[model samples]
Target: MDFSIILMIIGIVCVVVSFFLKDSSKKIEKDLEELSISIYQETNSLKRRLKVVEEELLLEPNFQVKSPLPNKTKSSINQSFQLKQTEAAPAKNVKPINEILVRQVIELKKQGYTLQEMIKMSPLSEEQIRYILTNNGGIQ
Candidate 1:
């Protein structure tokens, strides 16, 4: 074959290969875009779940409900006290701290155990120990 004919054949082969590669590259690009979208959606879902968990953790267990009645008769006072106790009971149930663990925390506080020492001794977190102590008239 002539050199020019050989060169023409090689150029044609190159063009054919480029066409095949172009199609495959387009498929790969589409797959990558789909993967990116899936990852983004998963990240958003995880963030939403984390936000809900944070809100639950930050909720106070000992919030008091004020009475609607302004009058202060002895009977009314007793009724109000009972109402307050009932309302507080439900709030306590919302965040179910272990009674045994709470008593342990209080006892440790009474024994003058430091916060860091209590954290090391107990299974509960620092925040949990602090909350128990503060609510039970222990040190801040």
Candidate 2:
């Protein structure tokens, strides 16, 4: 019932409370580490998906326009269209665009060449030229 005894009792209670707090802090730290690891894995997965989507976009199929005929039979027109498509099958083989070509497209855009002119000068399609210009910050 002295002041020193009261202080000793208070110190013992503080030590007991700190032991419990230490366990809770360890649990909190473990949870934070797990959350960070999950976030890192999800970020890597998203990056991989984005890369696949970009590759798919770059490998777009080729489409050709056909002019309307004034007076052609349906069967004959179908046959002719099928034949033309078969003949042009090789044209559908799209090649991957290289960095050099992308840079050239960017340079062409900077030199004030029209989109159509760029398409004619380069082997790339109009869409590819536009994509290069837009992605490379060449578009005004």
Q: Write the per-residue lDDT of candidate 2 for residues 1-140, one digit (tens) a residue.
A: 69999999999999998877757777999999999999999999999999997776555532122323222332343344445445757566434454445556777878899999999999876766765665554322
Name the top TM-score candidate: 1
In candidate 1, residue 105 scores what lDDT? 80
Q: Could you give me the TM-score of model 1 versus the true structure? A: 0.44
TM-score of each: 0.44, 0.43
Task: Give the per-residue lDDT digits (tens) of candidate 1, residues 1-140.
Answer: 69999999999999998877758777999999999999999999999999987665446433233433232332343354446556757554224344445566888888989999999998776766765666554322
**Global lDDT for candidate 2?**
0.64
Residue ranges of candidate 2 with Cα displaced over 4 Å: 20-22, 60-113, 116-140
Clashes by residue pair, model 1:
none
- Candidate 2 weakest ten by summed lDDT: 62-71
**TM-score, prediction 2:** 0.43
